[model samples]
Target: MKKMISWNVNGLRACMKKGFQEYFEAADADIFCLQETKLQEGQIDLELPGYHQYWNYAEKKGYSGTALFTKEEPISVRHGIGIEEHDTEGRVITAEFPEYFVVTVYTPNSQDELKRLAYRMEWEDAFLSYLKGLEQEKPVIFCGDLNVAATEMDIKNAKANEKNAGFTKEEREKFAVIKEKGFVDSFRMLYPDTVTYSWWSYRFQARQRNAGWRLDYFMVSESLKDAVADAKIHTEILGSDHCPVELDLEV
Candidate 1:
């Protein structure tokens, strides 16, 4: 089986200080992906001998960014969804291997009072189309902090958060559309009713109480569903507010 792990490191440099290297080495994933790196090019040097590193940095300094480390070199790599309007945030990185494409994305937050919901909706449409385009060639294993919970079951306090950015009806509907478009939520597919989460807020002792939202995900093309051996959340390991999620594939 091939193993892959994805995490929203929150900040790679800060995470490194908090035992990121130890966890990275121990996890030993075939492919590892990260979101919210919050750095510019050359900001920090990471030495992972056996892996090829690919990064996309937001034009704005100290903001959204993503990186991918893989044991197998990809045939090709691309950044963004090919939409100039949505590409500025350095939110996406796609690595194409012989069998499939690995995409890591740090999806945009709708922001306080849903101020950015309009743009986020646009992003959802374009991103979905981009994945479908890639699927024309091969299956896709896309992972990262998706920034929204697809259903009430995905969040701890669904009723209370009904109007919140990540759990709002608009965001949830968009997430549902992705599944409708030939993708399977790998973790949900394995543990359909598991009450686990990937992200928590620092404000209200959320992680301590395990009151969090399932924001990070690994979604694969529907055709690859049976090849999915296992899916998991590494809630025990911690460096950021969010934890690592893993997927094992028969491929």
Candidate 2:
């Protein structure tokens, strides 16, 4: 069994101060992916003895970034989707392993008033195409904070957030295309009716009230769907506003 975990740490440096190390160690995931690292090249030197680290940092300091730690060294690694327009923010990291290719992404959010919605739409197309291209060579396991609630069940107050950034009609429609392209949302496939979320707003005692959104995900190739043993939302183990989502596969 191969255990994989994904977490949007929000900011790696800040999360580290809040017991990220302890949780990371205890989880013991074979492949651990992180989004929203918010660090530069030399900002931090993390020491994970058994795991090799790969990171992609945005050109702007202390902004979007991603990291991947895996027990086994990857055969090859790619930092971005190769689209210069969308590559500026360090939002993607793909590692090719023996049996599968793992891609961790921190999708850009459509900020308030749907500010970045246009660019987010372009990203959805380009990123999905990139994944399909990789799937031609091997099975893919892509996971991270996708930044949208694809359905009403994915958010606590769907009606209230209908026109909000993450729950907008455009954004949700884009998310639905992912599964239509032959990928399986591992967690939803396992627990289609489970009303759980990985992220919550810090305001209004959202986490305590269980008012949250399932912004993070673990999606595998359609061919790999059967190999997925278990998918979990580890809300109990938290450091940032988002908790870790886990997947166990028989790869």
Please give each candidate's TM-score. 0.99, 0.99
Could you list the CA RMSD of all candidates, in the order they appear?
0.6, 0.6
**Cα-based lDDT for every prediction:** 0.95, 0.95
Q: Which regions of candidate 1 deviate over 4 angstroms?
A: none
At residue 64, candidate 2 shows an lDDT of: 92
The residue-by-residue lDDT of candidate 1 on 1-251, one tens digit each, is 89999999998999999999999999999999999999999999999999999999999999999999999999999999888999999999999999999999998999999999999999999899999999999999999999998887889999999888999899999999999998999999999888899999987899999999999999999999999999999999889999999999997
Pick out the ten consecutive residues of candidate 2 with the lowest summed lDDT: 171-180
**For candidate 1, what is the TM-score?**
0.99
lDDT of 2 at 189: 96
lDDT computed for candidate 1: 0.95
